[model samples]
Target: MLKKDIHPEYGPCQVACACGNRFETRSTLKEIKVAVCSSCHPFYTGKRGAVVIEAGRVEKFQRKYAGTRFGKPAQETEEKEQG
Candidate 1:
């Protein structure tokens, strides 16, 4: 037998999305906030853009390591050998 009053109250809840979308649902929480939802999710909207906060990080890494052998640049290694 399940005990009464042991579990928290369950009732209708409201969900608020960051994209300004709100909906009603049933949850333990009275109000919930989320960063993304079906209304604004990239997959659902089919709009894929840069979601990273720090942009250009990937480009910067590739540029810094271009033409490199091991961790050192190929040109630097050749110069050291000649010296």
Candidate 2:
């Protein structure tokens, strides 16, 4: 059984960040830091953009229609007038 104490302790103390970002706060222990804060982080600073790409997608499509007639010019349609 654990008894109630006036103070508590936490792990992972002094978390120094790689982006030179640091701050102080309270958790289950003392002293804590983090890497990549809102000042330079991609997500926090909105610097990163969406990524969209598929493997062999462009190649697959080109191989599927190597020399098809799909690129042909549009066909001319006759127009009729009704009174």
Candidate 3:
């Protein structure tokens, strides 16, 4: 068993989810703010890609890196072009 006074205060943690799901769990912190939770999570709720569609995070990333080549260094590309 852990000796008393050696550990940080462990008490109920109030979690506030973006989807209006509030639950209490044991943690060192008193409160936590989260963007997703089991109630509204895509995996738990069986919502495939719904969050991505609504948030546009995936689409925005794809658009930002669509033209970028992967696994090829910029210097290697320049050397190939020069030779």
Candidate 4:
């Protein structure tokens, strides 16, 4: 026999995502919030533009190493040649 009042309550719950997608489901909590969902997820929706970038990280990295040579930096290259 199953114990009564031992398990947490399960009822209808609302899920909201960062992309403004909302759905209803059953859960212990009354409301749920998530950063990603099927509607906005890149893998699920198969959209390349869905990717989110912050603070121009790719641009910053390119700028920082724009003058550097390939593979190793100048200091490492010099050290390798000496040893």
Q: In terms of TM-score, which candidate is strongest?
A: 3
lDDT of each: 0.79, 0.53, 0.80, 0.80
Candidate 1 residue pairs that clash: none
- What would the per-residue lDDT of candidate 1 be over residues 5-66, giving only the tens digit for each residue? 89888899999987788999998899998877888777788878725334567788878887
Worst 10 residues of 2 by lDDT: 74-83
Candidate 4 local Cα displacement, residue 12, angstroms: 0.3
For candidate 1, the per-residue lDDT at 57 reads 76
lDDT of 2 by residue, 1-83 (tens): 66668556644455446566566554675665554555665666776642213335677887887556443333411121221
- Per-residue lDDT, model 2, residue 76, is 19
What's the CA error at residue 19 for candidate 1, in Å?
A: 0.5
After superposition, candidate 1 runs with Cα above 4 Å error: 50-83
Local error of candidate 1 at 50, Å? 7.2
Q: Could you give candidate 3's per-residue lDDT for residues 1-83 as a string of tens digits?
A: 99988899989999998878899999999999888888888889897765532577666777777656544579877877799
Pick by TM-score: 1 or 3, better one = 3
State the lDDT at 58 in candidate 3. Answer: 67
